[model samples]
Target chain A: MPYTDNTFFLYYNKSVLTETDVASLDGILSKCSAGKQFAYPMADGWYSSAFYFGKGLGFEVTYNDHLAETSIDCDFDNATGEAVTQAMWSYVKDSRFKADANDSKIAAGFNDGSIVAAVTGIWNRTTIQNYLGENFAAAKLPTYTLYKGTADEEQTQLVSFAGYKLMGVNNYSKNKTDAMDFAEFYCSRENQIKHFESRGFVPTDVEARADERVQADVCAKAITEQLKHSKTQKSVPSTLWIPLEGLGNAMITGAQSGSFDLKTQLKACVAAIEKTTN
Target chain B: MGKKRERIKPNVFKRLIFAFKDGSYATRLSFLVMGFGQIARGQLAKGFSYFLFQVLFALYMIFFGGRYVGHLFSGNLGSRLSGERWNESLQIFEKVSGDNSFLILLYGVVSLVLFCVFLTVWAMNVFGSYENDARLERGQELSTFRADLRSLINEKFYIPLLLPPFLGLLVFTVMPLIFMVLIAFTNYDYAHMPPGKLFDWVGFKNFQAMFSLADGAGFALVFLRVLVWTFVWAFFATFTNYFLGLVIAMLIHKKGIKLKALWRTLFVVAIAVPQFVTLLLMQKILDGDGILNKILSTNILWLADQRYFSLLPRTMIILVNIWIGVPYTLLMCSGILLNVPTDYYEAARIDGASAPQIFFKITLPYMMHITAPYLITQFVGNINNFNVIWLLTGGGPVDNVYYGGGSQAQSTDLLVTWLYRLTTDQNPKYNVASVIGIVIFVISAALSLITFNRASATKSEDAFQ
Candidate 1:
């Protein structure tokens, strides 16, 4: 019953990308998911994608709490608890994934077929293509509740939801019923399969995860493995991206300079985040 | 009377020109010539070499130097190579466009013009030398270049001599200052980027926003509060060093003080170390778990605590700055103190003046008179004390009440530090930064001008005698 799910796999390369590169890539991915609307929420690196998707295709999108825009005046008192519950259910129903952008690492994984599919959050798909080469297939994110026993079972566990792009019904929509219907249809198993074959994400439908294509994709396989352990970033009421980002910069600089105490630095960062959010 | 006036009519300019036309072979050739002027003036090798150098220089400028000069103006030049795009709204990349090519072209043209002016000056010098040689050949007095130099020194030529450098200062310093002052009038915030976003001249909008009590953003009220703190910080920073330096100088100069050289060197060591190095070291030492904090387990968030944070860090920096600055003043005061006549002190003591009385009446008055100019400069230096605030607290423990765009600033930040952070920090507001810089300059200039006028007007009548 999940509307949509998009899985982004993070690939680790021992020799290629440094931790800083991974961090930078994380930034680019957040920006991508900013304005996107999808059937299922994605993991990290979805912001930039959402931004492009929403701006390019005019999708009604909601992003993760960390990367959310400051202008979204949704308050807890007036918040649609029903919508949040539905979104949570839809997100939990999707499989999580991981992928490395290192070519040699991907080649090794693909050769052994250890990875069913690789997840990548970078804007430049060309980089992923160059890294993965011709040996791998792509697929859409799988359903979150595939192994679901209860809502509590899903809630107890956390997933790598650092980057996510979600779909929402826009208030100004002319065809509300038709739009909802279209959303449900697009996220169905059959349509998910089509989406998976074309877009490099796991199929969002609950049943579509069993598709042969989903089973065969290298990035998708790795993502499913990570989905079991993925945890979404905690959402604060207000957006603290810019300030928190500044704290991150200060932390990195402090670390580089070896000046301030790291613990104090972290505390300063946390304080900054709390101040901005509250 | 008519003949006498006619005889004196060939003034300096006419005499030189006439001498050039009737001069010896070398004089005539050098005076009338351009490229080979040096050789005609008896500088055969220098003339040939300079001509060749000019040819090569011209060629180099035409082919390569011109482009380099143009690039200084064109901030876009690097952007072309790097393709660095400012990600405006997450996905949408907006290329930074307002490069102000006119500024670059103007810089380039000015540089070329300066080079040409240098050439013309060189040509005139050659003509002057040629005229001098002609005068010598005609058995008239040869006023040598050395004589000219001596006469220049005698005439207090520093007035005219410093003109070129003064003009340069006016162009670069004064003009930019005026531009920055103008920026303070506009609302050039983050929403209004230049070139693509033409920020109209909003007369006194920014200043009003910073000063008014009922502004919508409430940022102006915060700025006004910070401004008071800034002035307090400047006053303490300036005077603390002054008094400390004077005391140290007096102590060392005392007859009973031993190993004066050794004591002075110990303090001088602090001065020898660069401010950046010392401030950076201080930043490390004062960290939460840093050496200073580690010594005391009461773990004060020196940079984080809002209650006492502003005053504490500002006071700490001033004290630390005294350690660095006192020695310089001490050295200066020592020289001035020695120059103070023993007769003044003896007369004061004979007249039954106490030690404090002598210091207050005799020493203080003399020091103030002699050091008025230095004190003004010191005040100016404190106003623009960028390194101290920057390397120490970095204006941190930012309060919500006074928050600007960033998290690294607080209410304690001096104008210079705030301006610096604006320009160099993330979300660089260059226009605002420049405006703050000008504000600092105006305050310093006004203070210095008043002090200068007072110092000159109130000089002792018998001091010059």
Candidate 2:
């Protein structure tokens, strides 16, 4: 049912960040200057989840027919999550790291030569490609050093959420046969290739993905590689985002200053995620 | 004797009883069958119209309204749980329909309102029949249907003039208001959405949650903080705009101020721009990496810094609101300033009063007395001002201490903005939003009433004149 990929990986300027430098967070940050920063929208819930999800923390939400969350079991406040939060705080405090990047901001920053690298999805492919030109490059999200300055420090690959845009025919459609035929035709390999050729949407069909054009795409290859470290976007509770965003915002703002207790903030975030109203 | 008798108007119940007791046979029959007296007295059009309404009410009650009213009175909104059923032909499960609670509540309220309207018409029918009997006793000829139509145009012209708007208010305003108020008492939230699930009335639970300081459900802390900020923001946003506007208008109006029209036009240009466009432009310009920062070569977060309890963003929003709000106030004050009589200034000058004394004794007091109502309205408007704060910061910089943990409130949020976030957030808690809405209404209403009553404009209207 999938039509294209809907997840984020690293988009770096090849001139600023070599392949070796793009392989690690420390390497990327070292190359980034105060003026030309590495953009990561950690204040956003979608992007912030990468840090916790990379450390094997996630949520299992149960939804009823009404699409209401009936129950949620989330482990984003566990010991490992606290360590991940600490590790994020280490680089988030760096002057070269920008934690508030949105799509337009990333494009503008790249166009103005203020951003050397950013973490975002394929939706910004055309704009970033236009801005960076021949220097446009993408790769799987880099490894982050967890629990730095201690014996437990380890280089772990950053995980991301992998989502898909799906084409579906409603069961109650008046012309079910026609709708099904249209859906099939719309998602066919050739049409998907055409779609990618024009709109830059990565096709979901296996044969379509194997096309020469798709294989040549750096974004497509990065997305394929990133999928190994990703979790399916399903089963994420609606309550998760706002609280995680709050947590992410807190990290970027108060983490370096030690104005907030990370453990307490994490506990509160988890509590809010599991909160239910009768 | 007749004049004295006419002066003593009988109450409705007394009139009804007296009509039934002292009326002729036709009037007595009309008590059982509406318009019977009117028809017997040869007012055919009016009588038939009343009879038509009776028949229509009966048909509506029997066919449509009876079911919804019954469901409303039953108190359980709906009982059927939507589920999947086996379909042998399709070889898959198909969704079975269930009672939709939302529609039940909607139609129930509509039926209740219509019943009230029907009762009003029934009272009119009885009263009309009684009047006819009284007219016949005086040996007066009954007015013809054509004469009645003529009266609607001549003496009762206001009826047709007001009817459409009255009906519109009842349907569009009153019905939806009651529906929203009722939602505050119910468990109608994301989890209890209708059609697929049922929401039961949980009276005062949402309100308790809002005010309760219990850990994990401590919205009270957030509410109190936002409430304080709302008041603070309103106080500053209103008065700052007022005084600054007065200053600007007075400066333009001062003697020897060359090219006054040019000054006025410049301010008017600010007003001509749509408010959202201006606010959005301000948002972009004041952003961390925006043009302002680029120009200043500084990395200061104009709208996103939460340090010192979000002093920066809060200050920036109020400052931006002044830019948006001052022009209107300036225009209003300009008109009022011209209206202030020249005699007061002449008298003050003759009395050797300084300019400051003259402004304080004459101009400022006069402006305050005349613009008291405007100030109160502006204050209440500022309290519920959602646009400037929302478009600028989206109530952001996300203060972790109070607004975190799914509070959905932020440092710079007004009650209206927080209420907005509650309803629009991914996990919408509509009941809480409605409760907040009711709170805003109560606050705005009480503040306006108390202030308007005490304002010198209301207290001594003739004193100024």
Candidate 3:
């Protein structure tokens, strides 16, 4: 049974960013001052995937019964991925952009008014709401410019990885019938609404989502809007994260401006992800 | 007298021959049946205890330990791999039981260690029986069970006192060490976990993978970089703390300095707080957007910038470590500095020695002679220092150009942290981690042995006195 949408969107200060400014990465970066920065955790694997995935680049992985990766097919090192890498580098090179944002940093930044906007998930909705008070606002991820200053430049909406929480009964459970009944009861629409009311978990059930409280939540609406531009996070190899984190760290550290070859780095990263041992 | 006793001490084979050739009838019988001679001589308590031990060993071998010992010689850890079988009646697949390689290895090691212990006890029983025969031939009065128990409390008190700790060391330290060392020779990794899968003995393949650059394993490259950084960090961490601590201690001990107790108490307060807490606080303060940067009104990435190959973060880590480390040395050096005899300074002053000359010739030499071992220990501890680096940087500001893709090592990682990452990673390579463990042990052992042998403290222990 589905529980809620698990994805990220943009959280901003409405006093600093207008609705039009929140729609594009350029507008947001331009509006952000040195004192009040825009935070995006590009050095993290989970957040860094947005740029590549937004351009339709992804990985397909296969594993044996032992959960060992048998093979992986990935196109994240191709030309499309290079263009996405360039787009990420463009923002990271800006002084107004903070690339090392984490849970604590985001909270501290919002509380001290050092960060005007940040890209994070719904898990932080309550803390951010308390910090921003009436100035709190949310929207789907802004459009990023690709191949800027070139003839083939384009603006595309940043895609995010969406995940779903599910309740399942173990196949070897001693009381399978009871377990199944319990799992179903836990995911029922009324229970889901109760869960949302208590913990701020967005409901997966359509009828439960139509509840007055959920309908008015800016974070829930933003999540729903972001889901339209999201890809399902399934079958991603465990090897993908470390290498991708390295690449993201490199991009944010200005490795792109040097003689460093992005294509070779991406190629090595893909090869590492696909590597298998006997 | 000692030389004569040493000459009389027979080898095991000679003693066994002598026991058999010149033994009484009961002693000869005791060769095949343990404690027979003692039983015939009416040492009921000793004889029965030996007999009981033999019975327990035989039962353990027959029931519990024999199969694991057999499997140890089977080459592969286990023969069968676990899988699932179809159950047509229930329309489901059932899990099939198979040999667990991990259990096989663990039980095998335990059985081997127990066998060694049993052999030692068996040797004691044989020798004890022979001693009983000798006492009878000499027409000496034998100690009864009560006297034997009394003697254990008196003459053998040290044996009872040492036995429990010895057994504990064997079980906890020695057994786990052997298990980890043996894991280096096997393919025990995340993919080959037991029950669902079985790992085989790969024999030295992990070592080769770590040392060979031709295979593109990339471990050799990472090893060299981490090893070099480890030594470099240790040297700087040790010496910086030592010299600065010595200077602070001298300043406090100087005649003109007032509020000496207050200064010492302040430094002691630094030490009172838990080390990890101080390190974590330093981490937050040194962050790119932390309080330090805000105070300076500059956006310098004090600990996160990886440009120029993470020079900023690495240097900041050593600086933060100095903050946490210097106070400990300060406390130690203060005590040692006080103990430096006033007579040496008086003699040096009479000889018209300059301030720098007295310090270099008399003070520095005395300090070094006493603290040589402490310095070496501090050096080795710094090499394995995981807390400061882990808390401050997490071995990060990860430079992909140097570490490459798929490498868990970061630019700031010590070998210990890298080994930790290898074991905790998603695709954990236990064999590789074991190999790194062995390397760290060898390096620490060699360095400590070489330095300790040459150190003035060990070489001339009586010189100062």
- TM for candidate 1 is 0.49
lDDT of 2 by residue, A28-51 (tens): 998989999999998788988898
The Cα error of candidate 2 at residue B182, in Å, is 2.2
- List runs of model 1 lying over 4 Å from the truth: A1-278, B1-203, B351-353, B403-409, B461-465
Please provide, for model 1 over B382-403, each residue's C-alpha lDDT reduced to its tens digit, 9 standing for 90 to 100: 7777778777777654543345
Which residues of candidate 2, in runs, are more than 4 Å off? A62-67, A70-73, A170-173, A255-264, B1-32, B82-96, B405-407, B451-465
lDDT leader: 2
Q: Candidate 3 on B323-438: residue-level lDDT in tens?
A: 88889889999999999989989998999999999889888889998888889888988889989888988887666557753556788999899889889887798888899899
TM-score of each model's chain B = 0.62, 0.91, 0.91
Q: Write the per-residue lDDT of candidate 1 for residues A38-120, one digit (tens) a residue.
A: 11112112321221121111112244432332333222111232222233323322222221123333343434433323344
Model 1 Cα displacement at B339 (Å)?
2.7
TM-score of each: 0.49, 0.92, 0.91
Off by over 4 Å in 3: A167-184, A210-217, A255-278, B1-32, B79-97, B451-465
- Model 2, B115-203: lDDT tens per residue? 88887776677778777766766778778999988999999999999999999999999999888888898888777876777887777
True contacts kept of each: 0.00, 0.37, 0.32
Q: Cα miss at A34, model 3 (Å)?
A: 2.3
Query: Which structure among the candidates has the greatest DockQ?
Result: 2
